[model samples]
Target: MEARLKKTECVKQAPLAQILPPVILGGAGFSYQVYPDPNISQVRQVLRQAFNLGLRAIDTSPYYEPSEELIGQAISEPDFANRYPRDQYIIMTKVGRLGADRFDYSPSWVRCSVNRSLERLHVDYLDVVFCHDIEYVTEEAALDAIGILLEFVREGKVRYIGASSYRIDLLLQLAQSVLDRYGRPLDVVQNWAQMTLQNNRLETDGLKNFRDLGISCVCNASPLTLGLLRSNGVPVGSLGDFHPAPAALRTAALRAADYVAEQGESLAALALRYAIWRARATSTSDFQVSTITGIGSTKELDENISAISQILLPTHGSPINSARVERDAPLWNKVQEILGSWLNFNFTSPEANWDVQQQKFVKLKL
Candidate 1:
C-alpha cells in the first residue's frame, strides 16, 4: 500500500499537457510526397493506423497528392464512420490554391474547392475550412472568397472558418475586415513553429499582435525540425528525401542536430513534443502526419504518442513565474550568431521586392 502511494506520487510530477490531452494529430499522410507513389492501398493502411492511434484531428489540403480521394476511401470503408463518428474528429482542409501550385481567390473557386474537398473526404461538410496561404491575397479579395465559405458555414456545411499562416499584415486585415464587414472574428491561424526556437516572421513580424486579438494558432513545421535534431546524433538517414534545402541550410541543420543531441532525448520525439509544450499556453500545435510520406510509421506514432503522454502526466512545482524571462534566450542568440553570415542575400517578396536584411540562415530551399 505504501509502495502504491509512492508510485502514484512519482507519476504526479510532470507537465500535464504532455501526458493528458490527446495531442491534436496532424494528418497530411495520404498525400504527403514522402512516399514513392501513394495509392489507395497505402492510403487505407495509413488511415487505419491513424485512427487506431487515437488521432482526433486530421488536416489535409487538395494540393496534397490524392489526399482527398484517399481520405474518402478510408472514411467510406466498412464501419469506419460508425466507429468514429464524424463529430468525434476535427478535419481541417484549405482552399485558395487553385491551378497547379498557384493560389486563387475567386469566389467561384471557393465554392468549387469546398465541394471538391467534401467529395474527396467522403463528407457533406468540413469541420473547419481554412483560407490556405493567404499571404499574397488582398483583404477585399480574401473577404470575397471567405464570403462563400461563410455561407457554407451558415448553411451548416462548414463548422468554422480560419486561415493558415497568412502574412501578418494580411492576418490583421482579414480579422478586421471580418468584424467590420461581416461582424465576426476568424476562428484560427496556422503558422510554422518548431523546437529550433526561431520565429523568423512569427516573432519579428506581427504574429504576437494577431494572437492578442483572440485567434487560436495551429503550429506546423514541428517535426521537420525534429528531423534536423536526429541527423546529427542518430545517423538516421531516412529524412534524406524529405530534406529540400541548399548546402547552407543543410549545414545549419547539422548544427541543429548537434544542439538537439546535447539535450538527451530522441531529436524526432523531442521536436514533435516540444511544440505542444511551448504552444500549450497559446493554441494547439498541429502534428503533420503523412501516410504517404512514411517518415512516421505506426511504430513512430506509438513512440511519439507515448512520449507526449508521459510528458503530460502531472506536476507540482515551484510557482510558474509567468514573468520569467524568455526561454533559451542564450541559445537563440547563438543561432543568430552562427547563421548571421548565411542570410546575406537580396530577394523580393512574392508580394513585393524590398531591400531586406536577414541575420539568420536563409532557407532558400523551402
Candidate 2:
C-alpha cells in the first residue's frame, strides 16, 4: 500500500470552489485512444511539470483505459511523491458508461467502482466522483448513483459529487432532480464541447441553469471540440472514430481553421484562448468556472499554460495585452462569420439514436 500523506492545509480548510484552479489537467490523452504506448517517464514529467505550474487538478476516468492506472503509477514515483504529496493536488474521476454500449449505475456497481478507483489511483479518497455521461442512463439510475456518491461523501471516501454530460438540458434536469430528491444541489457539473469557439451553449444555456441550481463549481472541457477545430481536422482512431459531428459541422470547422491559418495563427491556440476567456469572464459569485484540457507532453502543457497566462494575466504591472486582444477580436469574429449557420450548433452524440430508442421503449412500457 502506498503510504498515506497528510492533507494539505489549504485543501483541508477550503471548499471545493476555492480548491480547484482555473485550469485543470485532463488525462484523456494518457490512454491508447488519444496516445498509443505512452511512456511512463513522459507521463511523470508531464504530471510533475503540471503540478509545478499550478495546474494541479487531474481529471481522468476508467473508460480512458490505463489513464487512472498510469496516473497512479506516475504520481507514485518516489521523487514525485516526495515533492508533491497527494493532498497538494486534486484527483477527479468518473463512473458509469464503461463502454460505448455498456452502462451500470446500480448502487452495487457504484460502490464497486469507487473502491476500484481508489485502488487504481492509489489514493485514500477521491476529490470528486462524477456520474460519467449521465444522459446515457435513466434518470432514476443517475439519481441512485448520485445517492451512492453522497453516501461515500458521508463515509469520507469522496470530497464532492457531480454529474457530467454533453447535453446541457439533461445536465440541468439531473441537477434539479438531485436537489428535489436529495434536498441538496449538485456540488459540481461538467460539460464538454459546448463552450468552444464554434459553440457557446454552455455559456448561453448552461450558466443560468447551473446558477439557478446553486451549483458551486462548473467545468468546461474539450475546448478544441475533440480536435474538431484543429488545422489537421477532427481526430480519427480510437476515440476520434466515434466523434459525432455531422459533415456540415466538420466542413464549417475546416473553413474556420483555414481562415485562422491565413491569419498566421493556429486554430487550436485561438480556441484555447477563447475558452479560457469565456470561463474567466462568465465566472460569478454564484459559482466558479474552470476549463479542462488534455496534455500529452510537457510541450503541450507549456503551450496551454502560455495561453492561460496570455488570456488572464498582465505582463509586469501593465494591463492585459489590449493590442493583441484587438488583433484577435476581428479574427475571432471572422471565424464565427465563417461558421455562420454552424455557430452555436451542437452535434448529436454517437449514442443519441440509441438513447432515443431506449427512451421510447421506456415510454411504451409506461
Candidate 3:
C-alpha cells in the first residue's frame, strides 16, 4: 500500500484545453511529398493512435495533397465515430494556395475552398480555417478572403477565423488592420519553423503582438525547423525551386547537422523536446499556445507524444513551472552556441525588397 502511494505521487500531468488539444496533430507528414502515399486504413489507424494518446485537434490544408480526404475517412470511420463523436475533437484546415507558386485569395476562391474542405473532412462545419500562407499573397487579398470566410461563420459553417504565415510583420499588419476596419480581432494565428531550438523570433516578438491584438492563441508549427536542425538533414527540392535559403545557409545547416550527429544524441529528439518545452510557455502568464507538429507514422507520433509528456512531467525537486515558461533555456543556448557560425540562420523577409514587397500587399478596391 505504501509503495502504491509512492508510485501514484510520481506521475505528472497537466489540465487539457477547454475546447481543443494543446498539441495539434498536423497532416503535413501525411502529404505525399513527405511520406509515401498513405492508404485510408493506415490513416484511420494513425488517427486512432493519436486520439487514444489525448490529441484532440488535427491541422491540415487543401495543399497537402490527399491529406484532407484521408483524415476525413479516418475520423468518420464507423468504429472510431461510434466511440468518438464529431464534437469530441476539433479540425483546422487552410486555403489560398492552389499549386506551386499559384495563389488566389479572392472571395470566390475562399468560399469554394472552405466548401471543399467541408466535403473532404466529412464535417458540416470546421472548428477553424486559416488563410493558409498569408506571406505569399496581398493584404487586400487576405482581407477579402476573410470577409468571405466570415460569411460562412454567419451560416454556422466556421467556428473561428485566422491566418497562417511565416512573416511576423505581415501578420502584425494584417491583425492590426483587421481590428481597425472590422472592429473584431482575428481569433488566432499560426506561424511555422520560427519557434524551434535554433530560432526564437516568434516567442520574442510574435507572442507579445498576439496578446495586444486579442488573439486567443498563437500556434507553433514545424518544430523541426523544416528538417534543417535534424540529423538526417533536409531533403533537396522539397520547399520548391525558388528556395529562399541562401547557399551559405544551406551549407551551414549541413555542418550543424553533422555536429548534432557527433553528440551521440538523436537530433530529432532533442529538437522536438526543445520546441515542445518552450511551446508550453509564454511571455506573460496570461498567454497560452497550441503547437502543431506533423507525424509521418505511428512511430513518429509515439516519439512526439512521449517527448511532450516527458517535458510536461513534474521533476523530482521541482514541479513543472507554470509561472515562468521556457524550461530548457540554458541548455538550448549552449546547443545553439556550439553550432558556431551556423547559429540563427534564417530567411530574409520578402518586404526587404521594395518592388517584390509591393506585390504582397497591393490595395484592391472592394
The best candidate in terms of lDDT: 2
How should the candidates be ordered by TM-score, best one leading?
2, 3, 1
Q: For residues 225-339, could you state the per-residue lDDT of candidate 2 as single tens digits?
A: 9878788877654554767788888898898999889888988888888887788777754467888998788988887788777776633333245555666788788888998
lDDT ranking from best candidate downward: 2, 3, 1
Each model's number of backbone clashes?
9, 0, 0
Better of 1 and 2 by TM-score: 2
Two-way lDDT contest, 1 vs 3, winner: 3
Worst 10 residues of 3 by lDDT: 1-10
**In candidate 3, what are the lDDT values of residues 1-366, reduced to their tens digit?**
000011111122111123444578888777765666657766877889988877878899988878899999888888898987876677889989775446778788888899999999998888789988887777888988888887887777887788998888889899998898788888888898888877878988888888798886778898877666666556333444344556666566556556666765555666777776677655233455767888878887887877676565544333234322354444456567765565655675544532223443344446
lDDT of 2: 0.81
Instruction: Give the lowest summed-lDDT range of ten residues in model 2.
Output: 1-10
Tell me the TM-score of model 3.
0.83
lDDT of 3: 0.72
TM-score of each: 0.70, 0.90, 0.83
lDDT of each: 0.53, 0.81, 0.72
Number of the top-ranking candidate, with TM-score as the measure = 2
For model 1, which pairs clash? Answer: 14-314, 18-308, 18-312, 19-309, 19-312, 26-287, 29-290, 29-291, 29-292
Instruction: Write down the lDDT that model 1 would get.
Output: 0.53
Q: Is candidate 1 or candidate 3 better by TM-score?
A: 3
